[model samples]
Target: MTNVLIGVDLGGTSTKLAFIDENGHFLNKWEIETDKRDSGKYILLNIVNSISEKVKELKIEREQLIGIGIGVPGPVNFETGLVYQCVNLGWGETQVKEILEKETGIPVVVDNDANVAAIGEMWKGAGKGTKNMICVTLGTGIGGGVIMDGNIVHGVKGAGGEIGHIVSVMNDGFTCNCGKKGCLETVASASGISRLAIEAVRKTKRDSKLKEWYEKRNQLTAKDVFDALHEGDQLAEEIVENVTKYLGVALANIGSLLNPEKIVIGGGVSAAGNALLAPLNHYFNQYTFSTVRISTMLVLATLGNDAGVIGGAYLAKTYGDHIRKIKHNSYIKELT
Candidate 1:
């Protein structure tokens, strides 16, 4: 028996897929730019065809494959296998599970990508061996995943852990995609960081290399801010510091509520590395309760872009019976 599971990470920009054995070893991996012109159905059909072709090429028997799991960059009804909304891809109320199962003739499971990323990090990345953890993906928008007692926490609506939507600032806020003001992501995400940099340069009348850089590069991005920071540019450094402070405040809020064993930071902006992490850590320490004997570790995510794919595999392997057993074991231990 092949006992192998396939994991797919469906992102707006790229689609990543991987096949993994029971031991979490990758049997194969690949990525392709997402076909946005196709509707959700056609895109899924392509995935089905790709998987079938791969199986034939590898000479792997259909019976050997265990199951298929997908992680999508939007809200999903995990219990019913329906996507609530995929605004990034212009998808609405998609029945992904039914379509994938019909096309592939295999059991299909799906969840929000951020939730699966938490599973990935918990399984093989920074949160390894920790039963309780959270992952914050600091991309164009912040995405968060909650893992409590070793399982993904999907509340009544499967919209749990949407920390970005959480409000941290009430005024002087940028409008968010969700039509909210002062949303955490609007201030701390990569896009937010760049916006701050641009506004600072324009408002402060401060001497910054950013204007020259933007003239040369055509557009300013968070990467430019990091580069400027590296060059010891004062304005860029101040913007970074402010961004980190806001991010740390959000982290402290999350920490206070969940008190997770660790918080794993991921995504492109996290590429700022120590320059971002150090200041965020400092702010988190300053804001969070000091006498609570808190010991949550903050660390950078290790799985990178592969986290969603690997996490989807882990979810496929354990979402049903295995997850239930683990939860039961935890409850029993608490009772004992």
Candidate 2:
């Protein structure tokens, strides 16, 4: 029987799950709405129930199922599977690994969501074949993952690779959810881009597509800014330029520090594609250290929503191999 691994990507609104073989081929992938009721106590129960049903449906025997790798939306102790906090899920110091494994009777591995996404990209997406990489998500908020020598950089407190919280604005800057002011996230995230766009609309005297949209709807999204820039809106161009300056310069600092093989950009904002990449590359080169400028790459993520699940499967594969090695060693000793 082919060994199967369960990969889980836990989120605030929905939990994505997939069944994959040891070789990283996804057999089936699905999602379930995250029940936030009663402090999310039912979340693990729901996951266990789903996995059992899927195993029965696929006729996967207990021995053929190897392990589970779960990525959670919080700072997590990879070794202990303890989640420090998950504001979106109402979780605090949850014992994720112990609970999940006890319910499912399978070996379990847990990691930060962003870290696993980076691993996914390294294993099968943009950073494929590369060991040193950084993955940044530019959605409503910024999330980052750093990998070095083929392993994730989980700091002493499981808060490593928090790139977005880098303070970029020193004076009169916007505040961040982390209770900091002028964070890179305050200027470069999707919401941050929109904030800049709104400021431009209010301050600029020049006529532009953004102003027209603002006058009509009293609002504009980051997508609107990019779309307007494509139509030659000077205001949109300026907003993007400002956004990229914060992003590229921040990345330059990260590059000089780690000199990663590739820095993969993902999330909703990456959908801007070449419009985003061209300007980002220009500023990244302008500020990056010499050797880092030549060596590091900035690329778009390819796996989209599947990155997390694929990454979870990768973790499961590694965990299973380790477990197998221990069992084999024990058997050999018993034989002796």
Candidate 3:
């Protein structure tokens, strides 16, 4: 019987299930809307049912499944397979591995979604072959992953890649969800760009198309800023420029600290492409330490939405194989 692996990508709004062979080829996949109205426990049952049905349809046996892996949108204690406080998902302190194991009767592992994405990138995406890499997602808030020598730097409390919370300003500038002032996320994220655009428009009073776009209220988004930039709105241009500058500086600082070979940027804001990358590169050159300035390449993430599933499968294969080997050896000793 061929050994198989199952991976679950548990996001804030949706959950994706993917099955892969030992060699990482896909067998089947599906998605479901996340049920966050109640506790996350509800969705856990949904995941188990879906995976079991798929396995039966595909004629895959219990022994064929080496293990299961999960990627969650929160901090994860990989050693214990626990999810810690996913604010977006509206859950706190859940035992992901235990519940999944009880429901599916398979060994389970879990890790943060962003961290798993980084591992996927390192394994097959933009960071292939390189041992050190950093992955950053520039959405509403900046999300990040750090890898050193093919291992995630999960830190003591699994808060290693909260790069968004890193201090960008010592003085009172802006508040962050982590209860800090002037975090890098405040200046480098999608919401940051929108906030900057709003502030810039108020100061300049520019009679541009941007002002007309949000005529009723101050409701604006990163997409609106990008659209305004495309339309040659001067205020929008200024906001994007500042955003690029600060994000570049933050990347430089991260490079200095980790000395990674590459930094892969993803998420909604990075869709701006060269418009953002050009200015960021300009400032990145100015701020980075000499060694990192020469070594690191800032590239866009290539994996897209598949990163979490792919990385989860990778973990399931590696960690599961180890456990299987240990069990086999122990059984042989007992027999002897």
Candidate with the greatest TM-score versus the true structure: 2
- Over 4 Å off, model 2: none
Residue 131, model 3: Cα distance from true site in angstroms: 1.8
Superior by lDDT: candidate 2 or candidate 3: 2
CA error at residue 32 for candidate 2, angstroms: 0.8
Stretches of candidate 3 above 4 Å error?
216-218, 331-336
**Pairwise TM-score winner, candidates 1 and 2:** 2
- Which is superior by lDDT, 1 or 2? 2
Give the alpha carbon lDDT tens digit for every residue of 1-336 in model 2.
898989999999999999999878989999999998999889989999999999999888999888999999889999998888888998877999999999999999999888999899999899999999999988888989999998999998888989889887889989899999999999999999999999989999999999999999999998999999999999999999999988999998899999999999998899999999999999999999999999999999998988899999999999899999999999999999
User: TM-score of each candidate?
Assistant: 0.92, 0.98, 0.93
lDDT of 1 at 44: 76
Candidate 1 per-residue lDDT, tens place, 230-273, comes to: 99898888888888888888888888887889999999998989
Which lDDT values do the candidates have, in the order given? 0.85, 0.92, 0.84
Clashes of each: 0, 0, 0
- Where does candidate 1 stray beyond 4 Å? 291-294, 320-336
Number of the top lDDT candidate: 2
Ranking by lDDT: 2, 1, 3
Better of 2 and 3 by TM-score: 2
Each prediction's RMSD over C-alphas, in Å, is 4.7, 1.1, 1.9
